[model samples]
Target: MPSTNCTTIYKLVQRAEDDDIEDVGNQLFGDGSSTMSVLEKKKRFEELYGVVRPDAIHAHPPNVVKCKGSGSRLPSKVEAAKKAAVKPPRRCGKCHKMVNHDSRNCDKERSKKQK
Candidate 1:
């Protein structure tokens, strides 16, 4: 089975592929700015191509349920739930602090006047 991160990334790539298809559709149909949302575009593409509609990969929520079923050597479901509930990790670009916000997007960096 794929690691959680790998599964998540796969979903993101699939969504991106869908987005690219939608862009092409807009070009072909010349639908002036009334373009379909990603979900709608994906549905249309699946219908036209006779392919399965891919899952919402970007919205890939972790499977805390699996953690629940596994034994103690594997973290308990409660622990998995805690990990899932915790805010996502962020790395700062400048100070490199793995705090709430990363350095690249830090306000301090944004405030710096370029020489």
Candidate 2:
């Protein structure tokens, strides 16, 4: 007679094999229907499970803190200031050129140095 653990493992293996066979069948017969194509079934699978397997990874809220009793922390004041201080890449309106600053502050020599 087989042990309980052995029987459990055998059942798991059997279920996995059955799933594999069904997957192969789906690929060959397009989910047991001739109307739907293999590509459609693949697209459906991707839409259901974004990138990771639903069974393998547990879903969690993005803002949830892992540490006990501690709430989600905000960015430091310095970090926030640094982010705010960052300017978008400026383009010269007159010459229609990409430069460090707008047309009013465009430095022709400095632009040459960049190249």
Candidate 3:
């Protein structure tokens, strides 16, 4: 072995600027010989292919909260509480009745002319 450290190999691949020195096949995957040391293989794989990690593996940062639900993410605690806390029905000042509509829009007065 002629001192093929990761940095040296990486530099060679990166510093190639000539037309004859086109980049290695981006789509190519390398399977270094089983006999090779784990570290050596990883370095060789990186030099021939791309970076240490594939692009797809790191396109998006990992989420802190893992969702085990059916595809859809579970709602946060705050959101769930908001949904669960139902607002009490408003009181109608006109009739002292607790209902949806307020006094201004109260339908309690049977005849409008009576008001």
Between which residue pairs do clashes occur in model 3? none
User: What TM-score would every model get versus the actual structure?
Assistant: 0.26, 0.28, 0.19
lDDT by residue (1-115, candidate 1, tens digit) is 5699899999999999999989876754557667667777666767667889655656767765555646647788999879867978678777676655576567765566352
lDDT of 1 at 102: 70
List the candidate 2 regions with Cα displacement exceeding 4 Å.
35-115
Q: What lDDT score belongs to each candidate, Candidate 1 first?
A: 0.72, 0.71, 0.63
For candidate 3, the TM-score is 0.19
Tens digits of lDDT, candidate 2, 69-95: 577679999998788568665667866
Model 2 TM-score, all chains together:
0.28
What are the clashing pairs of model 1? 92-102, 92-103, 93-103
Candidate 1 global CA lDDT score: 0.72
Better of 1 and 2 by lDDT: 1
Full candidate order by lDDT, most accurate first: 1, 2, 3
Could you tell me the C-alpha RMSD of candidate 2 in Å? 20.4
Candidate 2: residue 101 lDDT (0-100): 56
